[model samples]
Target: MIQAAAAILKKEITQELRTKYALNTILAFTGATLLLILFTLRAHQMDPTPKSGLVWIIILFASMTGMTRSFVQEAEKKTWAFLQLHANATEVYLGKLIYNFLFLLLLHVFTFFFYLIMMDMAIQSHLYFMSAIIFGAASLASVTTLTSAMIAQADRKGALFSVLCIPLVVPLLLILTRVTRFALIEGAASGALNDLAALVGYCGVTITAGILLFDYIWND
Candidate 1:
């Protein structure tokens, strides 16, 4: 299972690099978002604290845009059957989750640089923030990948994916945003142990569910 999943992930990563897909789009959108925020806050006195949740909001939307494309190419080709034949359900789910997590993590790193420049926010502990971003984004990415898989089978996959996923992801988004806002506003005062715990728990549960349920969805 592990090997199979790794292979799928490698294939996904190769395709993403070959086509310059998710990362490019995510970076472009992220850049646009930073620009918009900068212009919007130009005349206003921006809060040095976590007063504005703009970063989290931008991340959530940008993540959604990036994640949606993760499965789009496979779905377009109706290649679910071929994937299943190559690997078991667990491998498929894990591979998707792995690639999705890596994809989002890259976006997080790129956006963090932009946030520092645009907001002039001090990320006091670089290592700590990077670690938090990685875990938090991985959690969100896993959930998004599972939801994207579910949507890949639907008729209006993109729209339906958003409708279903947005509501489900609100809690994660809220907690992550609050944590990010607090860190940006209060520095190291923000201890994200709770959020991290919840994210890990959620990832475990969702990955398990995705693995178990994928067969039914794919066969349907």
Candidate 2:
């Protein structure tokens, strides 16, 4: 299982490196969004509440822009059939899950770095903030990965993807925004721990559910 998943991961990384399609799109979208925020509010002293909200908002929208590409590309390129034929349910699901998780994790971190610096906001606790980054990526990846697979089976993947995703992700964005508030304003304050725990639980539940449902999705 591990090896198969690793092979899938390696295949994905290789494809991404070769074409740099997803990476380029994600980078450009993320960078432009960050720059827009920087320019719009660079002068004002933005409070941590809205600042944190904006942080997750940017990540959320930017993530939406690129998250569907994994499965979408496979369909468009007609490699999805080959992938389905070659990989088992678990291998395909796990491989794609890891790829999305890692890809978004790095993107989250990069956004965090530039966002903090560009906004000239001081992070009260790097660890707390990073906790948000890791779990935020995981939560978004978990949802997007599974949704991508489900939508990949449909004709109107683009519209269906957003409809299915936005509802599921709203709660997650709320939790992340709350934690960001705590991280930036109060350090690792007591209240933030609950939100972090919520994130962990959200990841666990989504990933587990994705694994169970994916067999049917992949084989369909």
Query: How many clashing pairs per prediction, in order?
Result: 1, 0
Residue 139 lDDT (model 1): 72
Q: CA lDDT of each candidate?
A: 0.73, 0.85
Model 1, 1-220: lDDT tens digits are 8889899999998888798867787788989878877787671257654433566677888888878766666778888678877887777778888888887787877877777776667765454466558767777777787788777756977788789788877877666665665456555554666655666676667667777887776666
Clashes of 2: 0
Distance from true location, Cα of 149 in model 2, Å: 0.6
Best by lDDT: 2
State candidate 2's TM-score: 0.94
